[model samples]
Target: MLNRIASFALATLLLITLSACDDSNPAAPEEPVELDTQTVEDLPADPTVTVGENGRPQGLNQYTFFSLRDNEIVLESGTEARADSNSTAWDIALQGTTIRINGGTSGPGNGAAYVAEAAFENVVEVDTERLQPDTEEALAIPTGSGNGWYNYNANGQNYVRPIPGRTLVVRTADGDGYAKIRIQSYYEGAPELPADRQAHPSRYYTFDYVVRTDGTPSFE
Candidate 1:
């Protein structure tokens, strides 16, 4: 009996020691998602119906009104445009990416953090009616005032730089569809603004984004 009890105690200690030494590895972190980006060009300075170099009134990238005045891209609705006598021809604005309906009175709001995508394809489709405004997933666009929206890099060259890989996703104001956007630049031709010329007539917003018409989460 004594011998059997001693053997059982020894086995119990060995089992405890083995269990304490078992170190399971922790889980791996999730990979970041990649979103598709779209680009628009020569977005006019306002809804003045300026004859773009392409000789066309600015088409609403799915918007009823757009303007690049007051150092801000003011996105108003058609009714607001008509009521205020503003042009209802512009679509997207650069200060990051903002959109409003034909009659909306405000620009995109600071609602929520934009959710990045896993993978998306770039396109030239500016269908706003199908795109939804996501309030929770919006980001502020970079402007050319003060610190503006970009960081100045002095390491390689004194150049105005953009926040790399920063983006936003928004649901349409009506809550029907979705759109993803990212600011590419605040200057003409998406050129890097010179550090010496910080106030060089900003409000010229260049960006890439995708609009989803199917109301699904997939923006690819």
Candidate 2:
């Protein structure tokens, strides 16, 4: 009886020791999701029905919805984009100079955004604390000539251009991760010098972005 009890105690002690060793060295965390820089060109943001005298989009007011996760245009039509505006299928929406995320007053998703003054490549990590969702009073990405991501009639060029050193850091629609966007041009074909208003259509977006789906905040 004494021998059996001693053996049982010894076995229990060994088991406990093994369990402690296992706990000390937990499994390594899974690797963060890998993503590549993606460029989206000529994404129509409510292509104008007519060019005004000032060389801006006139009439046919609408928004083009885009999905950062899917990396595709979710909705391009005015009616369809509005109908699905409440859904999380899209992460961002654009119309003229206005940009919207899929959170707050925009949609039901957890999307949020803030414009970073750093260059796109220089922004290696996301500043999650500064992010804000769209609100009725104001948008996460502010609009206007000198505000947010663009400058209107820059250098008296008579066209809108993305402001240099301005990058958009966004909390993805699902709120699972983050993304960074650098708008290269606001004209069709991403012309180097969009001097001719008629030749270079307005409201078309050319931008590059990188998205991480693993919830990591670092772009590297």
Candidate 3:
């Protein structure tokens, strides 16, 4: 009788231990939330004070530092931008037609970028190997008219316009997140006819972007 009782006790103890082990097992991790696309309209990038005779904006050579994570302009003045230039608070900086990411010679952040030939919405993934940080000799997003994001004086047009089908694939300030940007208009209010300098003021950036902050390359 004692032997049978001992066997029963042992079985009960084994079952209890098994149940405890099952209860202690950790739960599976939840899936990361998908990020949404964000649109920024009329984010001023230091509007020019005068329009030159050549129909190009002149004067007010200052950069407007913007944060993609915050989706806001962090600094608009040259002095303030210079003071915070080394920080990662701002991801990108724009002055006239020139755009600079936060990495390399531009700033202290890990920011980098590359101009993709694909359409904005079609670019669902980023190739991190192709990304390049800003440098004195060359920029990730090249400067000059047709070389980079915008085309200057294309087809005899005097005003600058974003090159169609070109999208900017950017590594955020933290270097962990990624974002894709499509420049809709460089003029304020995103005018239908951006070449009409009289009506459409230049240097304002209106763009659509999708940011993924979960440290993933997927923009979806």
**Candidate models: Cα lDDT each:** 0.43, 0.89, 0.86
In angstroms, how far off is 163's CA in candidate 3?
Answer: 1.3
Please provide TM-scores, in order, for all candidate models, with all chains considered together.
0.41, 0.81, 0.80
lDDT of 2 at 60: 71
- Residues 3-34, model 2: lDDT tens digits: 99999999999999999999999999987556
Off by over 4 Å in 3: 1-32, 50-57, 78-81
What ranges in model 1 sit over 4 Å off? 1-37, 44-149, 152-160, 195-200
Candidate 2 lands at a TM-score of 0.81
Q: How would the candidate models be sorted by TM-score, starting from the highest?
A: 2, 3, 1
Report the Cα lDDT for residue 55, model 1: 86
Candidate number with the higher TM-score (1 or 3) = 3
RMSD of 2: 4.9
The digit string of per-residue lDDT tens for model 1 on 1-220 reads: 9999999999999998787767444467886345444566535433323366788645333333332112223443222444322343323333222333322334332222233322223322333343332233332222342232355543556454555544445544334445666656655556666444444433355656565545555554
